[model samples]
Target chain A: MASSNTEPVIIVEGLTARYGEVTILQDVSFEVYRGERFMILGGSGCGKSTLLKHMIGLIKPHAGRVVIDGVDITRADEETLHRVRSRIGVLFQADALFGSMSLAENVSLPLAEYTDLPPELIREIVRMKLGLVNLAGYDNHMPSELSGGMRKRAGLARAMALDPTFLFYDEPWAGLDPVTAAELDILIRSLNEGIGTTMVFVTQELASIFSLGQRVIMLHKDVKGIIARGTPQELRETSSDPRVNHFFNRQAD
Target chain B: MPEMNHRGYRLHVEGAPGAQAAVRLEGRLALEDLKALMADLQAVPVKMKPREIAVDVAGVEYLDSAGAMALIEMENLSRSLGIPFELLGVSEKDHGLLCLIDREALQRPPLRPESERPAIVVRLGEVARRQYRDVLEIMTFVGELVAALAYCLVHPRSIRWEEVKFYMKRAGADGLPIVALISLLLGLIMAFMSSLQLKQFGANLYVANLVTIAMVRELGPIMTAILVAGRSGSAFAAEIGTMVVNDEVNALVTMGFDPIRFLAVPKVLAAMVVVPILTVYADFFAILGGLIVGITGLDLTAFTYIQQTKSSIRVFDFATSLVKAVVFAMLISGIGCQRGFQVRGGAEGVGMSTTSAVVSAIFLIIVADSAFAIMLHYVRH
Candidate 1:
């Protein structure tokens, strides 16, 4: 057991999120420890993305709170939220890169906006971040000029531009070939192991969840909350819930 | 141990006679206290000038990326000044952060020099090349539209009558109120201004001739076409541009349907048919405005004003305006559809295409009107 003195970096308590009259997620609770790769797993329409958004403070929860480093993000003011947001980075599902900017400009945006660094130093940092993602010399290429996998890597580079403490990825391997997906998985693991930055990934891909996650929380649309939580080995070997077993074993209902 | 406290942060330096100097930092080291922390760190090398510096961050309660960057900068400065530097006693959280900084720093590539902007002649050549490509694309679009029209003529049943009616109502009936309002006001202003000049010489009766001939020959078609270009042309570009962005045009192509036939033809045919009818309305409204001016401002009876207007406008003048209306409609719809098909990227692309459609349509309308004016002058001679 971890020591009680070491506080969890993120504590999401009884979070209930809704869009209009439709409740997407309810009573969802989880904790992400420092230096851990946490995975949110569910099938389509299970509100994984919504949960991620609530955690990021992009969407206000219908109820409950997300406390990051002992500060409740749901109730945090703009100043507090800005500080919290600057410490974390989110990679959207669509990559959501600024369509008008080249890869270098996209990667440089957070640094430029947050710091008072000179342009020369900012450019050097941009090249370094892009290099980390294996896109070293493609600075002049626009987002439209990049392939799907390259754009995702660029988005990842942009996310890490400020050396954020917590990184959130929404479907990092959603639309990539097997080779590129494995490459990204390797990159994610290396980044986590090398830097120890806390990572939270939302994905339904069994391979990715097994490969990258240190701990996993499974959500269900029918339950409208987390249905199961455990490590991949534990879930695979000891879980008795039919849905959990079926999901882990890849058995169709 | 000697410690310096500033802005809620502390830095303690410990040095031995033959051992490396050690610096301990504590408290919140975030953006707010970054400048003070940097200033304090800068004084270390100047004051003690240690041959080797080791920073201990075990007591740091909070450290953001900005703090890490400042620390890295200090490390780099110490190294550059021939002082070896190292970080010691970093906690798990701080170690993670410092590791990120160290990794990024090690991987930091040399910055490339900014490329100079190309020479003016090179820029001009690029623009000319783009314009030439645009002209070719436009010509190809015109040819495809003509072929689609020919196909429709051959097989009348294949024509999308429903789409034609939809676009007709959207382009013509939906735009009627604004077009009528602007045309009425334009005619009123023209007649009022011309009457001010004609009344000076007892030639106020000629105001009726001036308004009628001008409205029928040039102003009516041009004004109606400009209004339609602003309204319907922009709409066409935006609607089809969005469709193109969403890959609906590609879907149509994959389904063995020409987008020109399915999309562009209905808009062009509708514009060609409705603009001429709108031009006739504009001409009538302008003549009525002249009649009003002649009666109220010139002390002439309404019948005399109507008779003067009727005699001034010939069949040739009316036909020429209708012909101009057709040409203007073709330009408006053609350019609008062409711009729509050229849409790339996303929502911004749609907006650019819409604006380009309106501007290009108006420009082509004026150019075509001038060409018609030159031809008419020679024909009259």
Candidate 2:
């Protein structure tokens, strides 16, 4: 209940997500506290990504509301949504960096568009952000020129450009070697600690869940809603739900 | 004393000229206040001309990274001017934000040079080398296409007739309306212009002669081919280019199918079969257009116009036009598929290949037409 002591930055109340006739998440509700690393875990074809999309306001839900920092993004106007979006960043599954832009240009894009800060200050911030992600000197490299791991790191740097209050990651560990994935895990942890940004991640990586997630919510396709909610350690050892217990045990094996 | 206030965020510098300066920052020092922050900070050294400056952030209610960078930038400016600068009363949280970035790293120049261009001679050499490689690539692709076509001929059942029918509908039947429209307009315009001249010589019936000959021998096949080049050629390139980008072409190869025979052969075969038929349709529509002008504008009977057109064009002329249509069809579809197979990058690459396909197809069609004119003349002689 230490998390309950803190104010909730994101409130998802009775959210229902549907694609055509199929319901992916129904009447799902959860709260993510300030400065918490929350992981959304589930089996394949579950509503993990659908829920993340609803949370980020990329896709509207069939029913319910997602309020981020006092603004209900699902119901917000364009101006309000734009304002709320400026305070957040998302890292996509494929590290969706613009192929046409250099790393420096990509990192500086948000600053240039949103702020009236001078170019030199923006450039300096770009360098510092890139430095934080261990890509200090790769400012001019194109997205196509970098390896998959480097591109992911570059994507993280761009995501951190505005020092967003909330950061969302969609399967950041996918398509990486174990070493690179572990390195990425450390980077995520450091960034969360350094900036104190609330993070929402959609992933099925058990190692990342155990290592990084402070609180976890598992979704099941059959349930069409949150199946389990607890600390990773608690979910591993003390979960009453057989499906949740089986998920933790099967992955560990 | 100089001060800047933007939305209650304020920067105040108190000092006499060429003397010690104390700068105080107050209110929310965040992103929205940064422009005023930098403007005020930049003005401090200019107006006060301080030999030493101290920035006090204790009055600041909140500070973010952009605000932190403003302070860092101020320190750099003072240092460059040989003026002593100090940051005072920064909270530990703000200090951590400030410490996250190393000033030295920001000062380091980027590894890449900005827009490096070679000497003119070297650029010319590169362009020439690229052209040579392009020609060689086209030759290799043509060789592969010939071999694939030969294989298909030996095994007629190997051709994917379903795709051929689909492409025929796409490239031929779908294109018929536009082809008919443009040919009709072409015939109407030619007959109108030529009737004015021939009427002066009391040869008004010769308008049919002129329109029928031009439509069948030259304008019919060439215009149809050019329109198809613009329509189906770009479509073929973009379709195959996107397939290459998505690695579907590679998948076909990996699954033990020749990509050219699997993808291009159907399109080429469909175009080769249908484009000539489209040319014949174009010729007929053009003649109908000429007949309209003959009966309406020139006061000539339909029977007279039809007989004059029949007398003007020989079977030899129709044969040449069909030959030209077949050759132009090959060039258009062939160039499109070749450009598609040459795609290397992503969406932009596909776009470039599509545009190149249309331009190269049209250019080759005109060149082949000119060569045909000369060869046919020598053969007739």
Best by DockQ: 2
RMSD of each predicted structure:
4.1, 3.1
Evaluated at residue A102, the lDDT of candidate 2 is 90
Angstrom error at residue A234, model 2? 2.9
DockQ of each: 0.24, 0.43
The residue-level lDDT of candidate 2 at A123 comes to 83
> What lDDT is reached at residue A238 by model 2?
93
lDDT of 1 by residue, B54-136 (tens): 99888888776557766877787788778888887777766665555444443444344335799999999999999999999
Per-model tally of clashing residue pairs:
0, 0
Q: A1-253 in candidate 2: lDDT tens per residue?
A: 4244378999999999989999888999999999889999988888899999999999998999999999999999999999898899999998989887899999999989888778877887898788777787888888888888989999988887887889999999999999999999988876776567789999989888988988999999888999899899999999988888878887441
In model 2, the runs with Cα more than 4 Å from the true position are: A1-5, A251-253, B1-4, B12-24, B42-61, B77-92
Each prediction's whole-model lDDT (CA): 0.85, 0.89
Best-fitting candidate, measured by TM-score? 2
Docking class of 1: acceptable
User: Which stretch of 10 consecutive residues in model 2 chain B shows the poorest summed lDDT?
Assistant: B1-10
lDDT (Cα) of model 2: 0.89
